[model samples]
Target chain A: MKNWSEKTLKRIWKGILVAVLLLIVFTFSPWVLVKGKIDPILFSMPYHLWVSILSTILLVVFTGIGGMVFYHLKLKTDPNANL
Target chain B: MTQYLLLIGVLYVGVLFFLSLRSRKEIKTSSDFMLGGAKIGLILGFMTFAATLFSTFTLMGMPDFSRNNGVGAWIFLAFSDAVMVFFILWFGFYLRKRVGSESFGGMSRLLQNCYQNKGVGYLYFIAVFLFLVPYVAIQIRGVAIFLIEAFPDFIPVWAWSVFIVVVMLLYSELGGLKAIIYADFMQGTLLLIVVWLVAMNCLDNVGGWSALFEQTANTQPDLLSPPGPKGLLSPQFLIASCIAIAMIPVTQPQLSTRLVIMKDYAALRRMAVAVGFFAILIIIPTVIIGLYGALQYADASTSSFLGSVLLREQHPAIAAVTIIGLFAAAMSTSDSQLFAMGNEFRGLIGSKGENNLTPIRIAIFVFAAAALLFSLVSSNELVLLARLSFSGTGIMGPMIILGILAKKPQGSFMIGLSAVALVIFIVSQLGWIPQQIFNMRLDLLLMILLSLGALINYYVKK
Candidate 1:
C-alpha cells in the first residue's frame, strides 16, 4: 500500500512540474505580448500585464503545492531527514 | 519631514544595535557566527531570504526600469522571480542532501570536495568576487544617490556611501550571520509596508487603477504592452533573464547558504512558498509606481522620478519611512554579500583558518572597502548592472550544479572552460567584443555553451 501511494504521488509531482514549465513558456509566448494589444483589460491592467500577473500568481500556487508533495515524499523516504 | 526622518532613523539604528548585541551573546563558535548554527526556522528563514533578494534594486531600480521600459517589466522581474522560487524547491533539496550541513563550509569548499581540485574552489571564489563586488557597490550607490537628492545640503554622495558601509560593517562584525538575519527580517517588513503605502498614494492620486492605465494608454501606449516603448523586453531578453534569475539560488552564495541553514527540508519547503507569495505581493506595487511615474514624470530622470514619487508626493511620515526603508534595503543585502564572501574566503584557507574569526573579520572589512571604492565610480543603471552581476555569477551555474549532483566529478576540464567563458563574458561587457553573436546575446550564447560543456563532461564520466 505504501509503495502504491508513493508511486501515485510521484506521478502527480511530475505532472505539476510540467504544468509549471508550461505556464512559464506560455507567459513569454507571442500571443500574450503582441506588439500593441491593450484591449481586454482586467483590473484595469493591459492584456500582456494582466495575463503575466495571472501566470505569476498561478506559478506561486503551483510552487506551494509542489513543495508540499516533495516534502511528503522526503518524509516517507527518510523520517530522520532533517538535513 | 526632516524631523520624522531623524526620529525613524534613530529608532531603526537603535533596533539594529540591540539585535547585534543580542546575537553576539549567542555566538560560541565560528559556525554559529557564519551559518547561524545551520538551523533557521521558516518565518525568519523566509524573511531573511526575501529581504536579501528584494533589496534596493526591487525598491528603486524596478520602478525606474518599468517607467522607462514599460509594463513588460512585470514579465522581466516578477515573472522571473516566480520561476526562481519554484526553482529553489527543486535545487535546494539536492544541494542540502549533498552538502549535509556538517560538511558544508561554503560553495567554494563544497566544489573543492566534489571535484577534488583546489583550483576549482579558487576559480569559484574569483567569479563571485568579480561579479558580487559590483553588485554590492551598486546597492550602496543606489541609496547614496537617493539620499544626496533628498537632503541636498545635508551630505555629499560619497559621504553617504561611507556611512552606510560603516554601519553595515559594525552590525555584521558585532553579531555575524545571526545579527544580519534579524536585520533582514526588519528590513523586509519595512520595505513591504513602505512600497504598498507609496503605491496606494500613487493609485489615489491617479483616481484609481482604471484611470491610471487609461492615462498611461493616452500618453505612452507602448508601455502597456511587451517589447516596451524602448523595445528592450524582447522575447530573447526575457528568456535570458528568466534563466539568469532561476540560477540565482544555485549560484549566488548568500542565497545558497540560506538554503542550507534551514532547520529541515520542511522549513525550506514552507519558506520557498512564502517567498513566492512575497515576490508577487511586493512586485505588484512596483508596477503601479512605475505607471504612476509614466503618467506624471515621464520625461524625468531616474533620480527625479524616484524622488518625486517616493518622497515629494507621499505624507511626510511615509516619506521618512521610505528613506529608512531604502537604507535598510541597501544594508540588508550589502552586508549579507560582504559577509558571505568572507565565509567563502574562510572556506578556501582550510583548517588553519578555522576556529579563529580574526582573518574572516578582516576579509569582510577588505571586501567592504573594495565595494565602497567601486560605488564611488559605478553608474546609476541599477537594474542592468544587477543583471550583469546575475549573469556573470550565473556563468558558474553549470559547474556548481555538477559539483553538487555528481558522485565523483572528474570534470576538472570544466574549470578551464568556465574560466575562459568568464573572461570572454567580462571582455564583452567591456565592449572589447560584440555583445551579440549572430543576433543572440553574448551572455545567452555563453550560458548555452557552458551547459553543453557540463553535459558532455557528465556523460563521459558516466
Candidate 2:
C-alpha cells in the first residue's frame, strides 16, 4: 500500500495533536485555578482518577480514529486490498 | 467434600474425552487443529472468550481481593473485560484482516516485520511461553485440589493432577482448538449457572446487599475506594490498568484469535459489545461469592484452603462452593492456554518441520510439566504469580501498538523499549529496586516511555 493520503494523514495528526493538548492542560494544570481556593471537580473524585479517566478516554478515542484513517488510506492505495 | 460434585467431576472428564475422540477425524491438517480453520462463529467465539477470561483466578482470587480490599478488586475485573472489548473492536478486526495468524507468536512475527528484528520476535515468543506455563499449571493444581476435596478418601492430589493433565492434553492433542472451544462453551455455561446460584445463596446467608456493603465498609472501606489499602494501588495503578487495557486489544492470545475468526469488522464490533456485557455479568457473581466468604469466615486465610482444611481435617459446604468455583476458574484458563500453546507450537515449528504433530505434542507436555513443577515449588500467592506474568507482558504492549500505527518502526526503538523492560524485570526479580517500584504499577510508565521512544526514534532516523 502507498503512503496515507494528505487529508487522512492530516485527520490523524489533528486527533493526536488534540490529545496531546488535552494531556498538557489537564495533567500539569493546578488543582485550584485561583490560588488558595479549592477546585470543585477535584472534590468529586481524586484528581489522579479524574485526570486518568479523562486521558484514557481521549487516548482511546483519538488513537482509534487515527487507526481507522490509516487503515482506510491503506485500503484505498492497495489494488489487492481484500477487505 | 460433596459426593454429588465428585460424580459431576468424573462425568465432566468423561464427556471431554468423548468429545476429544469424536473430533479426531476433522484434524487432518495443522490449520484445522490449531485454529479450526479460522471458521469459528459468534456463539463459539463468545463462549470461548468468556470461559478463557473467567478462570479459577477470578473465582478464587477476585473474591479474596474483595474480602480483603472490597470494590477495588472489581476495578481489576472491569479493566480486564474492557481490554478484551477494545481488542475485539479495534485491533482484532485489523489483525484478522491482515496477518490472520492463529497464535500470539504468529502476531509477534508481524511485529518483527514492522520493527525488523528477529530478537524481539524470539523474546515475545519466549516471554509468552515462560509465563503461560505457570499460569496453566495453577489451573491444573486448582482442579486437582478440588477433586481431592470432593473425594477425600479415594483420590490423591497427584492423581487428580495426572487426570486433569491427561484430559486437557488428550482433547488438545486430538481435537485442537475446536475441541477446546466446545469444552469451554459447556464449562462456561455450567460456571455461569453455578456461580449465580452460589451468589444468590451467599446473599441470602449474608442478609442481602445492604448488610454485605455495611460489613465490608466497616471492616475494609479502603477496598471499596479507588486507591485501595493506602499504598497498594495508586493513580499509577489505574494508569497502568488503562494502558494494559489498550494493549489487550493487541496482545492477548485468546482475544487476538477472536479477531482472526470473525467474518468481518462488523461481526467483530458486535462481538465486542456482547463480550463486554457477558464479562461484566460473569464478574458480578464472583464479587458476591468473595464478599460472602469475607462476611462469613471473618478470619479465613487468604491463601489456598486445602492446606488449612488438611490441618483441621474438616470441610464445610461453603468450602465446597469455593472448590467448585476454583475448579471452574482453573479449567476456563487452562483450556484457553492449551489452545493458545498448541496453536503457537504448530505455527512456529510446523511451518518448517516434517514431524509437526510430534513437536506440538512435546511443546504441550513440556509446558504442562514445567508449570506443574513451578506450582509445586513456589509458595507465593496465586494472584501474585498472575500479576508477575501480567507485568512481564506489559513491556511488549507499547511495541504492539506501534506495530499497528507505524509502517516502519526503527530498530533502535524496539531495542530500547525491550532493554528498559528487561531492566525493570531484572531489578524487580533481584530485589535491587525498592518494594514500592514493584507495588507501584509500571504498565503506564512502560507504555508512555515506549511510545515516546518510538516517536523520537522515528523522527531521528528520518
Candidate 2: fnat, from 0 to 1? 0.02
Measured with DockQ on alpha carbons, how good is candidate 1?
Answer: 0.72
Q: After superposition, how far is residue B251 of candidate 2 from its true place, in Å?
A: 2.9
Model 1, B395-420: lDDT tens digits are: 99998987777888666888889999
User: In model 1, what are the clashing residue pairs, if there are any?
Assistant: none
What are the C-alpha RMSDs, in order, of all predicted structures? 1.5, 6.3
> In model 1 chain B, which range of ten residues has the least summed lDDT?
B96-105
Worst 10 residues of 2 chain B by lDDT: B306-315
Point out where model 2 deviates above 4 Å: A1-83, B1-3, B100-105, B145-159, B303-328, B353-355, B435-443, B458-462
State which docking tier applies to candidate 1: medium
Please write out the lDDT profile of model 2 over residues B248-313, one tens digit for every residue.
Answer: 446556556656765555445555655666666667776676666666655766544333332122
List, for all models, the DockQ compared with the true complex.
Answer: 0.72, 0.09
List candidate 1 segments past 4 Å from native.
A1-4, A76-83, B101-103
